[model samples]
Target: MSFKSRTLLFVICLFVVSNKLVATPKVKTIPIFNIQVDSLIEQQSIRNDMTQLELLVLYNDALKEKKPADSVNIFKKLAILNADLGQPEDALIYTEKYIKNTLDFSILNSEAYNVIRGSEAHKELSENYMLQIDWISFIFLYVALIGFFFTVIINFSKKANRCAKLFISGFVGVHSLFILEFVLYISNIQYRLPHTYLIAALTALLYGPFLYLYFKSVTYNFKFRTIDLLHFLPTLILIVYLFPMYSLSSNDKIEIMLEINNSYNINRYVIFISKVVSLFIYAILIGKFHYSRRKEEDSIKGKKPVNRWKKTIYAIHVIYLVSYIIYGLPVSGLMLSFPYFINYIQVSIMSVMVIYLAYMAYVQPEIFKSYSVGTSENTIPPLEKYQKSGLTNALSEELKGNLIRLFVEDKVFKENNINLEELSKRLNTTRHNTSQIINEHFNINFFELINKFRIQEAIRILKEDIHGSLNIIDIAYEVGYNNKVTFNKAFKKETSLTPSEFINMQIKKGLYK
Candidate 1:
């Protein structure tokens, strides 16, 4: 066949196949009885005075219909109604059906579930079903925590600061224990790890101290001292007191677990309360420190106000304090008395907090500038002679004027990737000379100097375009910022007001249309 004939044949074959695939009819099965059941359920559910017996009748009819998905919803309604009517055993049976059909174990720790857990009828179902299905949540938390821990580790490795490293390490240790406990619980092998409870108890004692250290380290640039070891005394004492549990026989360990589980041990309650009290104290201390730091920064002139890192750390502490009050205190026995679903809700909140923490840590700004850390004053002579380079004072003055002209008239600072090397090249000078001049004259790093000009330009534009001609994001890009977040941060740092707030202030002053 010729080329055109062969191509035509292939096209015809593809078109026929495509049409057949598109025109094919789909097969679906529908349960005729489920339609009637759904209609009845919807009608009864909407009625103001539906009786428990009527709900039970619907549930029985749903079971006889043998439609698993529809029956599951009916079983859930029946469970709630039976429990309300004080028929816990019947409620539990229906709850089990709902859980099995839906693969949801959120009700495993409910009062009704607890009532039937020890009963002979639901023993296997309660123990096996609860653990098996809950493993899904456990695995998710485990993986997420591991990822968070390593993320912090990567941050610590880059900076190599003792205080921050220890702070993050302590948190990783605590989270590791949580993962281990979940593992043992879900695997039904907690007794094999007999020392788990004692270790967890001891670890809990470090939670408040480590958190305190983390805030202290970031806010105050703390250095670890011998006195700092005293903070671990409480954790040590806990380990010593629980030392006996470490060597207990398997049977004895099981008894201790039972006692702890039943809240029969007064010491366990005491430890929990102590941890909460300690965290509260640290939170107050950190709040005071933050206030002092803010006051100190406010006193400095020509410096950008608002330390975002400090605020982020302080917010984390606030979250910790609130979480302890909600989920830690004994008087806040809400978690215990509430449904099992409440536990998962708490877990979800903590997971979000962890993710936020990881994000903040990952993007934490440089605490120390490059020249501030390793370079010494003696290494470079005084700025008067331009030191080892032999550049005269007159020439340095000329270069400074030229640099100002480039920034002010040329508007070179608007470029997103402007840096010392680029600036040095523009000035036809060595990078070292350019950096020294910026440090000595401006008393700031290259990035800070660039951002200062950009922020000033942004303010000018905001004032000129008054009738909201350009939105905050558009203004950010127009002023040389590549993204809105960095622009907002820089603007707020310089002016102590967000872009929107600045625009509003301009409008109030009649500077903007």
Candidate 2:
């Protein structure tokens, strides 16, 4: 055989073997195993559906049974399940129910809640439940309560000028009411108790007028006239304007509160602007009047306390005006950029002012006394009253020198029970002559002269008491004041500083020695 013929025969044999292998058939597998596997999966799905149905029934029963604890637990479970099942909207509903039932802000941070946390509903829900106690509002409330008590006491107290007391009472009372409304507004208590709506707005216009009138009454001893009623015309107009809101039902008011952003209409901005403008204008008026009086009081020696008090009051008013302007400009769209906290600062200024006035009322009741420096047409002048006196100028000068010697060298003003009569005896003069000498020579009343000497001595003693052993009452007693109130009054009159304030100032200045 040739070599090519042998190779061809071997290839044919391999091809025949491949054909035989291709023609051969293997054993067949059964379809029953796949069918059984599918059945098991179906059964598991049925069990899951049945379990979910049972949970739903149980949840409904729990609701019907009024079981809050059980309902909350079920709500959480259902929410998580719904989230895992790709039904996020349902999950959020159940989450809201859980949060509403428990008010549990902590739950929103759960890993399982991540599915719905990105939704806007979750954000709103979190905001609704997350409320921190507003400490500033609480402070305002406390001051308002003090203001109320002060108003009641000053109205009835026999001390001080009745007209001044009335004006101050109105100022404090109106401010207190405003603070209360502010508390409601900021703390969201107004939405719950809807009657508080527009109450602050109604009184907004009263702040400037009341404060202006108070300064007038206290400083100039100006009596209230019927024309003064016109100062409150803006307040009356505000009441009329807000009457619609005030007359709304509680539910309607709550609805308005919910949609508060939409309710800031032109009228609202107008009202807000009016409040700030009116307050600023009145503050300016007060400044002008106060400046003129301050200049006059500066010429006099014994008006230090009242002058200082007025300056402090005016400074506080400026602070409030600045803060309120900052707050109001944004609300009224006058200034574009302003911090949100300025409103709080404005209210806090008022609160601090109330607290300060209350303190002064307690410490220096004499400050509220009718200080009529101007001689009214119906009143007798101090000089005129002394016109018929027989006291000679020579005798007056001698008595004045002796009185000065008694106060300066002997420190006789330390006698707690010392009065004009006792002082006259010390100077070997009559009480009338001593009064004339104090008035003419010192340009102050006998009480004022005594207080000036006593306060000067008190300052000397306080400066020497570097050991800090002397308390206010002790220093007061050492200065010939029968009580701490009188002592505080005397001390503040001369130095325009409270006892503690003077000590602190000295400490700050390193002049404690």
Model 2 TM-score on a 0 to 1 scale: 0.56
RMSD of 2: 15.8
- The pairs that clash in candidate 1 are 466-513
Against the true structure, candidate 1 reaches a TM-score of: 0.51
Instruction: Report clash pairs, candidate 2.
Output: none
Question: Which of the numbered candidates is closest to the native, going by highest TM-score?
Answer: 2
lDDT of 1 by residue, 1-513 (tens): 999999999999999999988872221123335456546556555443345556565556567775565577677777765655556678767876775555455655555444444565456555544444465556645655664565457454554456666675666557455545655655545644555645556676676677667656644446789999998987788777767656666556655554433323436556667777777777787677667666444323222222455576567657755755665543344345544444444445445545555555556533311111122421222344445766677877878888899999999988777888999999999887787677656656678889889999998888778677888898888778999999999998787799989888888888865
List the candidates' TM-scores in order: 0.51, 0.56
Tell me the whole-model lDDT of each prediction, alpha carbons only: 0.63, 0.72
The worst-scoring run of ten residues by lDDT in candidate 1 lies at 366-375
- For model 2, the stretches where C-alpha displacement exceeds 4 angstroms are 1-136, 260-266, 298-301, 333-337, 374-513
- lDDT per residue for candidate 2 within 21-111, as digits (tens), equals 8872221122222322213223334356544544444444444554465567667766665654545677778877775565444665566
